[model samples]
Target: AYIAAPEKTAQAISTMSPSLITFKLEGDHLNRLNIPVIRRCLEKATAVVVGPGLGLHKETEEALKEVLRIVEEKGIPVLLDADGLKAFANFKRRLRVPLVLTPHAGEYKILTGDTLPGKLKDRIEMVRRAAQELNAVILLKSNVDVISDGVRVKLNFTGNPGMTVGGTGDVLSGIVGAFLAQGADPFNAAVAGAFINGAAGDFVKAEKGYHMLPTDLLEWIPRVIDDPMSHVKVRRSVPRGL
Candidate 1:
């Protein structure tokens, strides 16, 4: 069964395939859901990705909180993005479960409530501060992606301006979620996710130029991962008559 707000049902159907059941309601309706029903869904899910295309509604926000609470209590790993970050802002403190928060610069500012410095050094410091405070891995998206768990940080400089298109962030979020489902550590998952996502974008740029769209990036993702290295071969051929 799928769990989402009423308005998101159609989107969920299209995005999450196989015709799964959907639980549609906001935070207020969380209590109305039978405990066993939620448990059953949790049991079936290996990992959960929250906040993709989920809009900001009071009831939806509350429901997200409850979902986070239960997931944490059950020791489930979660990948938080988009509206999920907004819901987290309303909470008092950090969450218990291992989580990865994928935020762009603007979203990062909202989560931390701290003004970002215009310089690169200051931005890295800001990311560290927010990650340490939240006790969760942070993946900050920009021209050069910065990922940190408050201890180690990685800078990815693979992507190009072509990646500035919409849904690129969502693609990154999905990549991280896929890694988390496979049991990768949050830090490594973020690193790999950022690297691959950017590398794919770079590949798209090479093939289609800066006008490349987000869908172009998506198609290149598999090719980039399957063979990250560029190949070079020199061949010499002579005619049989020679």
Candidate 2:
């Protein structure tokens, strides 16, 4: 079930083969997700993904506050992204439930108010510090994706340039959310999700080259997860007349 506001966002979600239970907010602004609807949904949800297509508008700040309240009260694992980053950037209190933050470099800078360092070691350290400070897992997306839970940092190299398209990150969050709902620990869920998302992107790259879309990446997800270590074995044939 997806709680989406924008027509295009909703339409994009509709294309996916899931029964979506829609939510309403006044007007085009996704600021106020229906509280009663969301609360009801949370009762059945083991984990929740917030801020996928959620837009950051002035009015929606209140909605984010409500989301936080419900998450805190219910102890639900949540994966925050997009405008949720904006809400998270401003939230000051200590987080209660297991939380994962999926942020790109720009979003990381926005969240911490510090630019990531140029060197790899320093970048890893920076993410470590952010995770430790927030006491949450941070999945920093880059050419080499970094996952850190303050204690350990894992770098993911499974994805390719073909994954640069929009909504791929959303797919990552969804996969992670699924794992968390299925009772995988937060850090492990993040590590596995990042690897699978990137590996699926890599697989899609092989099949469709760089022209693949986020939807194309979806098809490879099950294959990647099922046979994660499997790869196309390149065969070398001798010249026929050799």
Candidate 3:
């Protein structure tokens, strides 16, 4: 369910217009996502996705903390994106369940406390170190997505420039969350999720080129998932320790 005040709700609704459930905030945005409500909603959730469009307003950050708390306490597998990456600044060591972090270069720097490297090898090593240190899978988004859980790395090459548009990462978080909920391990889920998310973008790009929007990419995800090879030209697997 989408949870935020009216103004935020309008923006979220525009992005997630297809969402089937929504919980609008009545007053303090933080207060709106109280533990009681979180717990109740979690009871029915197989996996949780947090931090998409979650702004850094103080109240929203507080709400993020509560969301993190419930997710940890309940051992819910979760995919953290956007503001959720900011929230991880505090809870990095507290993660106890299967968790995935999707961060672009800037966010990855903030989360890892290191400068993003210029070369591909250095970047892969950084992602690996961050995943190992945090004990979570990391999907470091870029032109060529890098996914690692410290032990293994998967490079996804199915997307295009069109996916740089806003809301694409949110679509990725949902895809990964769905995979995790369906019992894919954190690493494989991230691998497959990255593959699927990018492949969908490629599919949309085939039709719309650089004009493809996030909604188009979102709509194409299932199609890519159902016929992955059709999107990925050559399926190459990275070595276990690469």
Candidate 4:
């Protein structure tokens, strides 16, 4: 069975636990998707997570728009990340709900329609501005994640470079999606998701060092969440120089 949302879907085998389910979507044609089926799924879901391994394509863009429309009309909170952010770059104003957008620097440029100043402070400011313009929360991913909902800004300093492997962002999207399903607000979901994702990365890095893979990070998530103190000392110290 699959849990369909505005931008992404989490599918699982009935026998498997929810946390073990994988969340990813192919950026194929939206026309191929049955809107009625999707709408039915959304009618039973709490929130939706979009992006995560979704590549950019014209068909995918149109599909995202339709999904966003459905979510807005239904009044469900949505979390946008990865290609979801890219798809809405030119049409952000069309969105009419409280949204949480998670984007890296490159993706941030696309969403804001502005160039970053190549400095951390400037980029954080850009994220704040983007959140204000879109009337949504912005979670700018980096060494120090910055989150803003157009008013207050929060910084997350829990991750290390060892977490840079591919698919980690996808995992993060799923984590936030899970929190949303459990009834957390968008901003709290983003904040807790960032912390948990980073802490999981640190936990894996301690066991496998820099050679750790994204899946390794996922495997450590339970450990981090279950025993935050145990993994707190596992994080690699950030160096001072570039």
Residue-by-residue lDDT tens digits, candidate 4, 62-162: 77788789999988888888888898886777367668888887888788867767687887787887788788888888888898887778888877776
How far does residue 135 in candidate 2 sit from its true spot (Å)?
1.0
TM-score, per-candidate, Cα-based? 0.82, 0.89, 0.86, 0.84
> By descending TM-score, how would the candidates be arranged?
2, 3, 4, 1
RMSD of each: 8.0, 5.3, 4.5, 3.8
Off by more than 4 A, model 1: 1-8, 15-39, 231-242
lDDT of 3 by residue, 173-237 (tens): 88888888888898998888888887777777667667777888867777777777675442232
Off by over 4 Å in 3: 1-19, 232-242
What C-alpha lDDT values do all the predictions have? 0.73, 0.79, 0.76, 0.74
Query: Which scores better on TM-score, 1 or 3?
Result: 3
- Over 1-242, each residue of candidate 1 has an lDDT whose tens digit, in order, gives 35544434545665756665575443433333434455666776667787777767676676677777788878888888888787677773778888889888778777888777778788888898888888899998887788999989888766766677778888898788778878899999899888788777776666666777666777767866787653111001111110
Instruction: Look at candidate 4 and give me any clashing residue pairs.
Output: 7-50
Candidate 4: misplaced stretches above 4 Å? 1-28, 236-242
What is the RMSD of candidate 1?
A: 8.0
- Scored against the true structure, residue 239 in model 3 reaches a CA lDDT of 16
